[model samples]
Target chain A: MSHSFRVEATADRLPEANAGLDAWWSGAGLPDEARFAFELVLEEIFMNVVMHGSPPEGAPCMVDVILDRQGDGVVMEIADDGLPFDPLAMESPDTAAPMEDRRVGGLGVYLVREMMDTVHYRHSEGRNRLSVFKSIGST
Target chain B: MNVNIESTEGGVSVARAHGRLDFGASAEFQKALEGAVGAKPKALVIECSELEYVSSAGLRAFLVAARAAKAGGVGFAACALQPAVKEVFEVSGFSKIIDVQADLATALAALA
Candidate 1:
């Protein structure tokens, strides 16, 4: 009910987050599909923080992850303080086209939105908070 | 992840890969693929049954491999893809240009 946790948004912390989340997921008996979804969501969020959230050169963006177990899935709340941007408001890339024809960026976030069951975004108090939820199969 | 290399029948070289193929694997996968293609292997099989993840960087490495194979005129393909890994291929449109099959038998038959 109160599985609150926060992590800094840094490439180095990616492995730690993945391991910690994997442990939490396995402990909760989430299915492999859900695990993949969670990882994909995490990657998209992390990349956004790294590539777009920070300043042009780069800045440290703190990522706070609060995990809550839902009926049959887990809801993850992520907040970033780098920029005041809305992720859910972004349009998806054209997956219909070939790779060479497609744009280079935005595909990660687009794929994350497409895969996750629910994605919500909010900008409040100079922070971008993203809510992501995905249902997992029984392990 | 584990990678193994061996020679197929008629002296064709085949390299098999297991587990996730991602940025973490770029170096290993690139080296192996390059070596195999450099040796003039008739075909290369990237068995993706255990591969779980692939980022843009990983896809870039695969693209490099594809380019190399195409340049060298050596057959290259992947087989036994898990659904997740296969989805990455689909999202990137790699399934169209690269050789992809549902099973090893099909891949070998095609590549052979």
Candidate 2:
């Protein structure tokens, strides 16, 4: 089974992205933990596109999210026409660093990588595409 | 999202966060944190028993509040995290950097 949705790269559109996933996840019969994992990853990717990837000068911002159930796992594809930035390419912040020396932000990418089983990035035709995979019923 | 300051007793400021702390709630979360930190309480505790959901944006708010507490020489901690919220903290390694207690009493006592 598969589901897809498009979101304008606006903060307000987050609820739509979330609602769309909620409806499908309910029908997909995923556990609470698995659903939370997917929700976190989607929020991170969607917000990144809305806040950083999109141009500050008001360029058109759009993101396409596709979900597919494969065997015992689910795969999510996020594609955006914003900047050509690969979230995976960013350096991981030292999570163990003390509060005084810690840097804000960048935790989103780290969480996405940790929650998903496999994450791949591609930049094609002026678009950034990210594929995230996770096994169903697994935390 | 609704963040109500539950109490400020014995130099400990306790804030009860309710509802989803996702992207839409960041501003409200930050405002509440600011109010808590502004009091310069010796310690700050965010009770999350009523919090239903948390996303990266919510985590970011927590991080920012933590930083503010450190800068202001105030103690900060979180307690009563729902299981799913705890998982997010663990996965992001935030559990290592911040003080997360399993319940409200322990968190308040530790702050005291």
User: B15-108, model 2: which lDDT tens digit per residue?
Assistant: 9999989989988898789879988999999999999888877887998898889889999999999998998888877898889998989998
Using Cα atoms with residue i matched to residue i, what is each candidate's TM-score against the true structure?
A: 0.82, 0.92
What is candidate 2's lDDT per residue for A32-94, written digit by digit as tens?
A: 667888888899999888877888787658999999887678899999999888899878878
Q: Is the docking of candidate 1 incorrect, acceptable, medium or high quality?
A: acceptable
Native contacts retained by candidate 2: 0.89
Deviation of model 1 at B78, angstroms = 1.2
Q: How much is the lDDT of residue A50 in candidate 2?
A: 85
Q: Which stretches of candidate 2 lie over 4 Å from their true place?
A: none
Which candidate number has the best TM-score? 2
Task: Give the per-residue lDDT of model 1 (tens digit) for A59-130.
Answer: 677777777787677888878888777777777666665534545356667767767789888888888888
